[model samples]
Target chain A: MSDATEKEGRGVRAVETGLSLLGLFLDSDGPLSAADLALRSGLSKAQVHAYLVSLQRGNMVVRDPQTGRYAIGPFSLELGMSRLLTLDPQITASEEALKVARKLGQSISIAVWGRYGPVVTAVVQANDQLLNSAQPGTVYSVTGTATGRLFAALTNEAEAREIAKLQMAEVTPPRYVGACPPFDEIHEPLETVRRTGVSITYSFPQPGVTAISAPVYNFSDELELAVTMIGPAEEIDISLEGNHVAPLRALAATISRKLGFIGKASGA
Target chain B: MVKSPERQRGVQSVDMAIRLLEIVRKESQPMMLRDIAVSAGITSAQAHTYMSSLKKFGMIEQLGDAGRYALSDATLTFARHVIRNDATLNANINVARSLSAEIQEMVTVDCLVQEQPTVIFAVQGPRTPSLSLRPGTRSRIGNSAAARIFDAWSDTPEMNPNLSRIIRASGYAHAEGTPVPHLASLAAPVFREGALVASISVIGFPDAMAPEPERPVLRALLAAVSSLGGSSA
Candidate 1:
């Protein structure tokens, strides 16, 4: 019998079926097809398939190349990452980011690439009443900032330049974000990131806030992700450009290892 | 890469079940039980039974205002386990064999099933005596490079909480064959989307596999796996 026969239920049947199919993935280790979804969701096959096609086009789902089963995709990853950061990106990042925030006294932040410049993921607060309220889920701009260069490195020159344009157009003073003078300084630092494999920036996103940013790597020897800690000038380590780089570098490397990059020794 | 082990004396009901699934995969839209039965060369009664069970598992979906059947999202899980590990062995075997060449040992590719390490395939060099570690034997997740690779590839947050850190710190791992002390093995993890899913290992007698160009061999082996996959998550 069709679910429509039930009292007080009609269109809701399919929506419930759709949600139930997504729930099945929690029990499954891999992908699932329409049939699997129907079986797991206990809905009529037609209703589930329709919702899936719509989900696929919207980037809410991913189709497996081999099995033709569907699962969560990049959009989901972005959402998942956002939620994780909200719960204290510092905790998700674990001990080192926490340590950096505490030493600095000014609020410290570690951010990664999100739709906005850098999405502040983890944060360590300072004692001051000024209260820099940049929360974990907040997105920062690539222009006129430290994490900006790291975000720039995520893409090629053209993409960064394009991002710079959009950012400046949206902010005050209305000039090219790339035209910011500090941006010119980033070219050399980014090159160092590509070479020596780490980067450091001064008085980063906001003036009076100095920062250090580093890339986490693994056995693959690829600079796939970046981590940055930003805070007020007094608590920031200017010596870090040389003396403390290894700590941040080591922390990034450790995070990279945890993320499964394990570098040269692992066959990469 | 190794295919799933073929089953023997499999149930007639299971065969019909698979055939029904295939029909849905091939069909453009939902098919009624009659259509499914005809396609699978079975009676409608049998097809109805299969469909009833399949519907319970989320593998098949019903379509239209009326009841017709098609594929659903759940089948991908079964396919991923096979497909993900397929490349793990294919791109890795030659590299593992070549690495084994310098030490004149046996090279093998392995994966995990529920953390039970199993040799999926192996190639023994001429200098070494043929080893008994054949494909399809399940082993402990401890004491082998292959196990480390499997644990590393797993997405579970606390995979191998005891040794994961050590394996990460050390890079690649070595096995003195705690499972079999005479056999010394070395393994490296293959990562995909930032998770370790497979391992390639070279194994042989400790005396015969003396320290001869092992690092270069593993490096070459790792490079080969990287060619087939992204370096990190």
Candidate 2:
């Protein structure tokens, strides 16, 4: 190779290493110290600091002056929002959610698989009363809500199981009003969803609320988004074959087709 | 020629790559190579090198027959990571969601982003209010309760000479029927480690949302803020 090509390769490698450091923050639970990053990324402490200084300069990472720990920066968020503005799933789901909310007269939320877990992207409240718990940017638990369980059931299993395990670990018993379900226990519910193509949770994640959720798939026949319809528990029928589930499942199928999911119709 | 002090210290290529990415970020449309090159004041060949690295990482995408480039999926991944990893933001978002759920009123979390009071999170009330604010909505200085809360607690310049004094005394700011007709809002500051970090605001109709210091809505708002380690007094 020419000398110039070698130098260019080194430059690219530097950029790649710097970006990998930023990627670590995505997987981490919170802001990380330089030493923590160095340990996780398998780089020397001094090398990690050098890359952090570069990432910080680029506004890819920010160091809290008080704590000296690094977190992802706002510039990255602007870039993310720019990409999300054109995302096909969110746009289609938001429109479809509004329509479903209008037709059914219930609050609806559209959740897509964000980097962390299922993050709400759009919410359409019914006209009569408010269901304010689910808001855009709220990340649902993989094992907790209907929207979350739908995604957890439909997506890749190992990743879903891992996320479920972490969430179960974090859950307190008091929140469940009893012993929180064991990590292995979610398998049965998820398996049922895989067979049924819909997930339901009664008065969970919020009391007096029942949510029925279905999945939207992309061209690759992969789970792309989960559309959940929430209403008062006493009013919403919890049966898998009930009137409420039919419209929600139908809406998910319609959205899936719009997204080019040509596999056998969902919930089949 | 000597490099500027800012550019001289960090990795140069990473700096250039971020600059090119920012140029693409600022444009609404997918930009051609030459446009990005011109925007960054770099040669097309030089810009191509950086663009190649960014595209390799899925940070920028070249689209269609024209080869116009735009920010790509990696940016969203990074953005979500940033949003998720910020412990304080997540706690505040939880407070907004639960408070709105509890009070049956719209609640929002606002913070000063780049010196502008911006809505970082919002939860809609049960009863459909006249105005529904979305995340990323920027609040103006004079009329909004959030702006007033920031002025009262943070370094933002006070809009009213006595506004900060009154808000400081009351431990919250109230704006009624001004920013939008018939809308009333109560906003209280949230402090983490004694520094004003955000404002939690409840907004709704005037009849249901009277701006009283001892009202249940204001108490709930203050309680939520206090749970975040914010002192209302």
Candidate 3:
């Protein structure tokens, strides 16, 4: 190899080893010791020691005083937050969700279709009821909740079927099999939601709870998020003509508009 | 300028001392001199010499009666200095400070680092006790509000799908008197673009943050986060 190539190769190897050491923390159940890192990274304890020193200098890792295991340092936290700031949909939707929740005296959840399913991206709750509602980062089931139904209505048929399959597998306590509807039964409601552009469900996923969800579109007019309003069934009216439906639709529309949806498309 | 061999040797000693510090930090617990020497690939005698110098500089300290060594307060001070200077952390700290002042409750900004929820910045409210707002504290992902937010938004697979669903539906996590006694915490996620970046939490005594009073605090926190996030974005 040329001298420059050799120098670059050495640099890449050093970075690889350093990155491998950092990667170990992701799979670790807790903090890792140098010996543990050495054992995992296939590096000698001495080499691990040197790498640890470099990581520490960069503030990439920290040692717990009580456990004596190396954990991610504060610098990594800074980087993680910086990366999260670039997600425009979450920032825009979250601000709107908070405002709607306060105005309606209900809980609002904004969810995006994640690889796992519909993952909640943001949530805001009005006080005086359901203070312990769904939190951000929670995932919704395609078969069980309003948000899920909304996603099932908007998502592609093949992906929706895959989510449905996962949901079927998720129904625990085989004896409670009757509680989870068959796939065919699920399709009817999803089809209705797709046509109407809104989903209102009661006593589903949880008893005595009601949820109303509408879709938010992005610049491409794809289903980017679902905004849902949830509360107790007794207090929240889920009827088509109820007080919450119009405002909920309006909020979802407002967010969709913010996302550059001009409302030209109907199915989205 | 070329250094004299003596000055070069001095620089090597400083490097060795830093290596010793790294070994102690890697263990995550206090380490004995023999173990430190073995980890650093130095003799116990050499390790002792380096430890003495590091202790003199307040970078390392000896535990009582035990000959074990650990990073000292000075090391944490250095870490705190880095946190203060970091751009993202500085902005979060300012938002946390303003929120704390407005709500009169301790506010913390936590992020997922190495898949662990760790606090990077904290501002204690006037009424809150000094004991709780330490930066760099870690909480269990399943139990704390901040950890739950990180878990819910992170691409990592969920540990409990049911809990994740509930947290997603709720939009915020609340743990009453958990991770700390007599302290209840409610945390909301702060997003940038469409990704969850961090969680801003308000912690206070349960009675002080009762349902009625907490409404305003939650509203203020959401408003503060929205404003801060808008500016930062």
Candidate 4:
């Protein structure tokens, strides 16, 4: 390699070493001292300290005077907030939702947790005649909708109970093709969702309309949104192991991965 | 210019990279290639090499048609860990949120950063009108109650002996209608592990938040401070 290329190669290694030091903070339970970092990284204490001082000058890391341990600082906070600000889940999942809808010949809707309950933020119709109530900005009833049951099942128990009880008071029971359980008896359906990792509503909101929903998670493994496949009851299979259900689950996991989720096994 | 001790010990490439980052942060705006090179006292070609390295690391990026470089959100992953991993700051932020909700007044938590009191967390109370002291807002010693609380507890020569004594005796400071007319604030120092670490304050109208011992707000503020083991000092 030429002299210029050799110098550039060395510069890349330095940047990689600095970033690896910062990356170590992500794994640590709390603030770490230079000695702790040196142990974790296999670098000498002096080398770690020198790199840390440079990182500190950039406000990439901050050293506490009292404990002499280092933590992430303000500059990184601004960058992180900026990244969060630009995350439009609706936009991120729209193309994938549409692709899945085409593959399965079913309509799809994306739902996010709103103040009231699960609120539908976007929808992709498989065809013109796919009559469904999954409209943009429509708030799904926790005791009434498939997307609602998914959130009510997976969220913190206390919060899920509150949301379930709140919707029980606000919405009236919808007529079902089959004899549906009373609105107050929602525990069984929510339990099913928790066990199956998906929710199925069979022709409750509208006669001949059935929908199956699964959750999409963010980097933190928190339930960020729900992706639901909607269709006519006769055409859609609502069983957990049915042909359509597995694809829906796979699609949800794919979108979750795109959003930086890593907790779940890939393609599981 | 003399090299600081840190510069003497630090890696040359890492130092150059940080100097560029500091320039971007201080400018608070996207900068062109030549400008950054001139400020760092390096050639444009040399600046380009460092800038390329920073971009590859996701620390900085070029924006719009101008190709001016600025900090990127790539560092947010690291930032998230930084904010989440600090136990003391994290616990106090939770306290600030709950106390503001319970009292229906804007609550702010601040600590000394380079001797200036800087707000690290703030929750607006429902009852209080708008207050501008968001996170990262800074104040000098005499500007606000949080700043004064830090000054009172520290042994710096600029510390007022009488004010320090008063604050130490009461465990809080009351600022009534001085910083902003008709606005009042009551601040208490937060101590952890037997050392003064931060200050928490409630801000609102003077009538609702009077600076008196009998006032329920003062009692509540003291209660919140004690719950955190912050009243030890």
- Per TM-score, the best of the predicted structures is 4
Docking quality level of the chain pair in candidate 2: incorrect
- TM-score of model 1 vs. true structure: 0.35
Top DockQ hit: 4
Which pairs clash in the backbone of model 2?
A130-B126
Candidate 1 local lDDT, A30-149, one digit each (tens): 567879888777767865655665455434467776877787643332222222112222343555556655554445566655434566666666456353545677666575555667
Q: What are the per-residue Cα lDDT tens digits for candidate 4 across A1-268? A: 3565567668757877887888788777678999899999999998897788777876778877789788877667655444443445567688789999998888999987765667888999886675666688777777677887788788655555665565555444622112233445888888899999999988866778888999998644457789998888988887778878999999998777555454432232
For model 2, what is the alpha-carbon lDDT of residue B231?
58
Question: Per-residue lDDT for B107-175 in model 4, tens only?
Answer: 888776545676655665546564545555676666577877878877783556987888878888877
DockQ of each: 0.01, 0.21, 0.03, 0.27
Residue-level lDDT of model 2, residues B1-233, one tens digit each, is 52332564677778777888888877879999998989998767667767788888879888889999988767756665665566777688777878877887778888776566777666555453546365556677566888888877766565776878888887788888745887878898877767787888888877656667577888888788878885543
TM match of model 2 to true structure: 0.61
Instruction: Name the docking class for model 4.
Output: acceptable
Model 2 scores what on Cα lDDT?
0.74
Error (Å) of candidate 3 at residue B168 is 4.2
Off by over 4 Å in 3: A1-268, B1-19, B65-67, B126-133, B157-159, B166-170, B180-182, B192-195, B207-214, B230-233
The 10-residue segment with the lowest total lDDT in model 4 chain B: B73-82
Q: Clashes per prediction? A: 45, 1, 25, 2
Is 1 or 4 the stronger prediction by DockQ?
Answer: 4
> How close is every model to the real structure, measured as TM-score?
0.35, 0.61, 0.42, 0.62
Give the better candidate number (2 or 3) by lDDT.
2
Q: Which stretches of candidate 2 lie over 4 Å from their true place?
A: A1-10, A33-46, A64-69, A77-268, B1-8, B27-30, B61-68, B130-132, B154-158, B176-182
Candidate 4 backbone collisions, by pair: A80-B76, B191-B230
